[model samples]
Target: GAGVSQSPSNKVTEKGKDVELRCDPISGHTALYWYRQRLGQGLEFLIYFQGNSAPDKSGLPSDRFSAERTGESVSTLTIQRTQQEDSAVYLCASSFRGREQYFGPGTRLTVT
Candidate 1:
């Protein structure tokens, strides 16, 4: 199976616009993660999904941020009423139980 893949490698949108980022994880991986990285900063964990359910979503910065994964397949991250501070690279990772994580190339989002 293929590694994780994210769509729209680059995205530029107005501050108030909404954006949807998609990620396709490797088949058979049971754990999926979403992270955000601001310019020059470390990756910030945003959410984690096991199978089709998310058990830890506390890392989501605000109500405007949300994510969901269907089983071990595709996942979507949505940002509503985007702000300048929301500009960053969104990364997705998937891992099998007790194995190392495989990260996606990431989606670079710029809010003007």
Candidate 2:
């Protein structure tokens, strides 16, 4: 019934470390999406999940990035071997068919 929510609103990790980001989409929303926004840049699509089927992960930047969503609930985005270039705001959104998505506050990641 609530809007999207993301854990660890801000994170700072050293390079090469691994980090796990979490997102909880609104209840009953069938389409969930993840995006990344670098400073002064537009949002970049990272992945999409619909229902219990395979996720559309075409937007992932590299093999070190992955995500999973169980049913229409919580989802996690894991980043392995973090690099400075990976520093950005990770955003999650969800929506039903034909409706605009509701976005989470975003996790501001800073890789040192």
Candidate 3:
């Protein structure tokens, strides 16, 4: 069984540019989540999707951030107009209901 995965593993871009990060969740998992961790900060939820439920995007920092998941599987997070403040590790996780979430290594985004 595949665990959650994310890539570029690392990203470097200039401020105001855009970046797209991808995630692949484990099979049969009905719930997916995205989080961002700034230096020395705990993981902050960015979005969550469960089955057909409406995605919870309340944690997205701004309109520049968005994500899409297809059939509880792969998901991509796009950050438009990236800013230096957006530099952080973006992590993806998946879980079955009431189970521990499995986390991806994360995409480290650096904006300069």
lDDT of each: 0.92, 0.95, 0.94
Worst 10 residues of 2 by lDDT: 93-102
- Report the C-alpha lDDT of model 1 over 54-90, residue by residue, as the tens digit: 4589999999999877767899999999999999999
C-alpha RMSD between model 1 and the true structure: 1.1
Q: Model 3 over residues 46-104: C-alpha lDDT tens digits?
A: 99999988999999999999999998789999999999989999999999973899999
**Steric clashes per prediction:** 0, 0, 0
Better of 2 and 3 by lDDT: 2
Determine the backbone clash count of candidate 1. 0
Best model per lDDT: 2
82 Cα displacement, candidate 2 (Å): 0.3
Deviation in Å, model 1, residue 111 alpha carbon: 0.3
CA RMSD of all predictions: 1.1, 0.9, 0.9
**Candidate 3 displacement at residue 45 in angstroms:** 0.7
TM-score of 1: 0.95
The stretch of ten residues in a row with the least summed lDDT in candidate 3 is 93-102
In candidate 3, which residue ranges exceed 4 Å CA deviation? none
Clashing residue pairs in candidate 2 (N, C-alpha, C atoms within 3 angstroms): none
Local error of candidate 2 at residue 106 (angstroms): 0.2
Candidate 2, 51: how far from true, in Å?
0.4
